[model samples]
Target: MYNFIENKNTDGVVFFTIPSFEKTKLVKHGFSSKIGGVSKGSYESLNLGFKTNDLKENVENNYKKITKALDLSIQNLVFSDQVHKDHIKIVTKKDCGKGIIKESDIKEIDALITNEKNVALTTVFADCVPIFLLDPVKKVIALAHAGWRGTALKIAKKTVEKMIQVYQTNPKDCLAAIGPSIGRCCYEVDEGVIKEFNKEFTNVDEFVFSKGNGKYMLDLWKANQSTLKEIGLLERNITISNICSMCNSEIFFSYRKDEGITGRMAAIIELE
Candidate 1:
């Protein structure tokens, strides 16, 4: 079973780490929970997205708390604009602090890959899949945000392809984790969405379940796993944290559960 290990720092901030990534000793990474922060209502603490209506100061504080808890640096954090597309960015040390401590040039990008140590790559999410990738041989790390649109667009596969092109990362030597998000149990989609999936993936039956009335339960976790496998990543190297964000709304931020207006949790990673 692919599972995430729960951890809480002395500051009371809670986050999760992928056991497979932890075993590598190549990076510091975690997915944050909405447990400890200063934001109020709806956002109600640990809202990491600056685009949200949550107070900017509160969001910054939340970053500081999460970074400290993850043993990451707030100043080195680089964020993705995440337009829910398949676009990717290659991050370097010079890109550190963008969208956080400094102004950002990253836009229309949903995936970020980096080989630079100490430069953290982050992507925010609310009821969306967060994909964490690592190549131990190349000492590379990447983070991707895969919502329904991104999933259909094959963002996960594209990210891996970019890594292979730029860093010459071999899929066989990589480890990946599908972080928490809205699960098939809660992710109801219409025929239009399913059509997109059918166009990109041939084994839709493995992850898509019809509920009638033009709606279906789509398993993004399984869909992403299929993407990884299609690119030659071993099934044993990929992990899926089957936790549903909407189901565990108390611990996570779920846009659907909160009816669109809610905070965003972050999936952060940095080479140690």
Candidate 2:
């Protein structure tokens, strides 16, 4: 039920933005796609992941292009460590550029939250769900990288809870989006992952589909949406992109579809 508007800048950098967040005029946010960048071969273009085998120089250039296109300050952007954990970091001005322009001491953080203006928070993805959260009332924005591990740990809920505890954010006043990722149609997992999901979620069947032979297809969008609603986010306020990265590898990066040799897209947001 979530619709994302795609936009192409004059530089040919394609990104997606949520209409709900766009209408608020409280934040500047965008999700990067594979359609733009300087990287070549497997990376092709718009590969934002620094850890990938793509040349570090090309990755840096991609950041510059995307930050400019999204109107985000590359120098002020703080990125998540993204070890698939539920750890959340409260970002400040001093924390700017820790993960990009400078050395980062922000370790093991899968999510980032900030109420400071112009301090963009970013997290990378390749077939992993990117959860964007905005507390319009508090002028706070958060970006979470929820891979299967993070989703099983309820990282989305932890992010909202951290905002509540730190920024006095009310969940009902927040807007959330489950960004593009591998959908159930292509995300097949074994019992090991299913066990983790079962421990954290009660209504597992609603999002987990069986494919026989002990295989299951997990719907991270649904799981994250349910997590947000359980913590008081209104159903109408949460947007599920429903865009499958694996199914649309042309514009999006999918680790599964690319056989573990793909680039990464980024989900970024900042309070304006």
Candidate 3:
């Protein structure tokens, strides 16, 4: 029921989003594609991150492209520091432009939850998963960055818990999307990572696959789905993008595929 279909306009920019999400007039959210923007080389076109070697001017233009396409305000969007932890923060108008437009971003923030309107919550990703949460009933939304470590830390569920605590948002009233990232198809891991998953999840057999030689293929999408379901979100409401960033390197940036030199996409969510 969830598909992150491509959207290419005459301007040469591309983005991906669930059709259902697009239909929700109360919110505007999507994952940007590698196409569009004006960056060159590995950071060519549509690079949204400032930490890379890409020119700041190019990234700034990219942000303008996205915000213009989605009808969002660049200065109102917040960003994440992403330390692979479960840290979730409550956001407000005070955090406007903390990441992109503003020079200072709230450091060490992996996930952000907010009930305020027009304050778009954005999380950066190359191969890391982007989790979007929306409680339409309460008009609350959140965005999270989940790599292997954040997945093991159950950041998705933790974000939900924070919503319930801060906004009284019920999981039943929430719709979630697990955005594109490194899939199990290309995300092979060593014993060090496997041991971490085994310790956090008892049903490792479900998303964890044995590939022999002490190696494993971890399904971060399924891992996050399990985490959300365990927190009481309806199975139907949990939409998985199912797109592997590494596999679709032509359109999305893959840290592994690009050998760590690439652009980052922004998964943005906000109430209109």
Candidate 4:
């Protein structure tokens, strides 16, 4: 249902763009992949995260690689510090280049929504979900980072509500894409996490499955998708990559697959 087109630039970096949003002409968006980069060791290549031990120069180059591929400006990017919360920051021209070049971080923000042109909103991911929303009619877009905690807080739903409050966006006119993350097959959780999800979502049974070992596998992709649909995004307009990071570690970074020390991938959206 989602069109994630893979393109390899001359630098050999593999990045993905949404074909659905590509037609807008007003914005450009894409997700980074594991392929193509300058970092070494566990980072290998294409790690856009700077918080890690990966050389600052390598991470910067990785960002440059993607900007070159997507025809975006690395300097115009605004990043989410991603505390796994539902907090949303409204982006504007003043916030451009905050997390990339001008400043180091935008503290405590997990989602970024913007209507301003050339201000690319970015959020990192490993096993957690990345929700991308675009309201073409309103010329607004949001990038949400939904870890299990953020999912329980219903970050996806919060993003939609924020768009409504800020841009007066109608959810029906929005396009949502749940990007690659750990799938139900590998995201096993204990009772504590299960309790959290149950507390926030009444229809938890729809996405939570029993593993029969005092553990449950949570389908965050489905959880976030349900959040979008419940908020009025058409089922047809929402797409799931269904690509599990744990399973495709070669092509994508996976927190679980790499055991807590791995490179990072980013979901980036920019208004033209």
Candidate 5:
């Protein structure tokens, strides 16, 4: 089971933990909620998305706070530019602080994986699902952002595949943690997304349930879990935080619930 930790500054944002990960003590990983930081009004505090209307200075301050909270050096953080595509970038020592220092430095990618020590893999999310991967045997870590589009593109499975191909990791030895995001109870989709799911999954109906009328709810967490299972991870090795970003708006930042104008939480993992 994974333990949840709260940030005193950020009211409702939290991170999850895996006991197996603690055994190595070589990897540091946490999922950030919308708490902690110094953005104001709509962003309040802990707004990580630089592109948001939030002031750059405040976002930088927030980044500093996050690095301090995690006991990591802000200069060593590596982030994804998150294009909502399936591109998975393999990080080396040279890629440290690329995205954070300058947006142009970050290659267009949605997921980041690396075996390098002291380089934290960070991804930002508002309503999208954040998936953390760790190879206890190889000591490699990955952070992935999966929205409906990314899920259909198999981003979670791709991250696992990248870990295997790049670091020679064994899926069975990999531990995965799925973080909070929009849940089925509040994630309603249109026919287009439904059609995409149906094309990929034989039992798509099981993951998508009708609430009433023409509205339908999609379980993105379960969808990503299914992808992980298909990629060869043992069901027991995966820990899922079932919190819903939409329903629990008080705790998490939900783009849907907040109407596209909101701060983003971050999920970070590194090899210590």
Candidate 6:
């Protein structure tokens, strides 16, 4: 199980700490909120995405604060230029600080995985689900960004598969933490998305329900959970944060809730 830790810094962000791996010096994982940065106006503070209209200096400063709070080195961080796809990149020590300084250095990736120690894998999001996977036994960690399209592609399960293939990790020994995102209460989907989800999910009714007015609400968090379980992870190994980015826009950024002009939060995982 994982325990949620609220950051003392006014950033309103909370990270989940897994008790089973706490004593091990293997991996560190955290999901960020929008409370602790130097940006102003639309971005406000703690925005991690550099492509946003926020000042580059503020984004850099915010990265410093986040690294300090997470007890990680900015030099070893590897970021993703997410295109909402299922492309998972296997990061190595040589790829450190790639996407942060040079946008061209960032590969078109949506998930990052690595077994190397001290190399952080990061993915940015506004309302998309940030799924963090850790194989404490294998000392492998992966971070996934799953929006509707990525979720339909089963990116979370693909990340687990990659870990197993690349690092010899077992899904049963892996623990997953599903982070804050747009909950079903606010994630209304149209008929096309709902139909596609039905095709992908076996028990589609459980995660997708009618919300009246010809709209349907989809529980992406649970969808990812089911995907993990289907990929051999035990149901008990998944820990989901019930926080909704859309509902709690004051604490976290939401692209749909904020009309796409918002900053992004980050979910990072690394082997220590």
Best by lDDT: 1
For 1-272, candidate 2 gives per-residue lDDT tens digits of: 43888899999999999999999999899999998799999998999999999999999999999999998779988988989899999999999998788999999999999999989999999999999999999889999999999999999999999999998999999999999999988989999999999898999999999999999999999999999999999999999888899998999989998899999999999888
- Tens-digit lDDT string for candidate 5 (79-167): 89888888998888888887777554666689998888998898999989898899888888998899998998889999999888878
The per-residue C-alpha lDDT of model 2 at residue 29 equals 93
What is the lDDT, from 0 to 100, of the residue 59 in candidate 4? 92
Model 3 error, position 137 (Å): 0.5
Q: Estimate, for each residue in 59-144, the C-alpha lDDT of model 3 and write its tens digit.
A: 99999998888878888888878889989888898889986766665888899999999889988899999998988889898999
Q: Which lDDT tens digits does candidate 6 get at residues 99-149? A: 775443666799988888888898888999988888888878889999998
TM-score against truth, every candidate: 0.98, 0.98, 0.97, 0.97, 0.93, 0.93
Predicted candidate 3: what Cα RMSD to the true structure?
Answer: 1.3
Off by over 4 Å in 1: none
For candidate 6, the 10 contiguous residues with the lowest summed lDDT are 1-10
Candidate 3 Cα misplacement greater than 4 A, ranges: none
Error (Å) of candidate 4 at residue 51 is 1.1
Q: In each prediction, how many residue pairs overlap at the backbone (N, C-alpha, C within less than 3 A)?
A: 0, 0, 0, 0, 3, 2
lDDT (Cα) of model 2 = 0.93
Order of models, best lDDT first:
1, 2, 3, 4, 6, 5
Give the Cα-based TM-score of candidate 3 against the true structure.
0.97
lDDT of 1 by residue, 168-210 (tens): 9999999999998999999999999999998998999999999
lDDT of 6 at 177: 79
Poorest lDDT segment (10 consecutive residues) of candidate 5: 1-10
Instruction: Please give me the total number of clashing residue pairs in predicted model 2.
Output: 0
